[model samples]
Target: MTANAFMSISLDPPLIAISIAEKARMLGKIQASGRFAVSVLASGKDKIAWHFAGKPNPELHGLFDSLDGLPVVRGALATFSAEVRDEILAGDHTIFVGHVRALNWDSNADPLLFFKGKFGALEDTRKAPAGMLQIETELMW
Candidate 1:
């Protein structure tokens, strides 16, 4: 459940997007409050992710705190405080786009990665294997 929430907006005009289920309780809070902070989970925080994912936790209420007056989870690899700028209805998900106002990151913290329904960490010291190739095709061409 500890997935990389790549919550970011363009800097030119400044925008952010956070996708949430329409039935989620947090969605109401976010919409009513008009503000929310994205806390990027750090490595070793898989338990926290699972807890937030609603897997069941008895003692995990109010685990996050307010950052710059915005709600944020602590011990994140990084955190971004944003204000709601726009909301777009996308089928069963609502994309909450915001304007980033503040940001911070832990120097020694490693990012938690989520892929194919599993949690993992990025190896900071490992370099991309040599001889990588990518190809893009344009239909116009």
Candidate 2:
């Protein structure tokens, strides 16, 4: 399922958390499998996102690459596979905390963002190659 409610929980042990509705089918799938993967879609991948969001575009299906033997969206900006470490009940949602097993990323692609109920992309201001943004601490205002 396409989700926006996820975050990095820790760095030391490489943990991440994702929240799913208590009644969501994916919840049981995760619980049974004891693992899950997150793929941060790149910009222009709205159709893929929408497909996973229950829209079901047949043309966008099967666009997955594997990480640690788990499926991740192809061409994703980043992918993370994890094994469930803990689960918490939060009202109508369940938060699953996982220990990251594998992580991969490509800085060349812009990220797909959902804000205020709309999909968008960040303005690319860097003129150089798509890579880590270097901080110039020496530059002054």
Question: Pick by TM-score: which candidate is best?
Answer: 2
Name the 10 consecutive residues with the lowest summed lDDT in model 2.
124-133
- Superposition-based RMSD of candidate 2 using all C-alpha atoms, in angstroms: 6.9
**Candidate no. 1 TM-score:** 0.77
TM-score per prediction, in order, is 0.77, 0.85
What's the lDDT for all of these models?
0.78, 0.92
Task: In model 2, state the lDDT of residue 98.
Answer: 95
- Name the 10 consecutive residues with the lowest summed lDDT in model 1: 1-10
Give the CA lDDT, 0 to 100, for residue 99 in model 1.
Answer: 88
Largest lDDT belongs to which candidate?
2
**Backbone collisions counted per model:** 1, 0
lDDT of 1 by residue, 1-141 (tens): 222345656986677788887788878988999987888888887778888787877866666867778767777888888888888989987888888888888999888778898889876586556897556878883
RMSD of each: 9.9, 6.9
Residue 70, candidate 2: C-alpha displacement in angstroms? 1.3
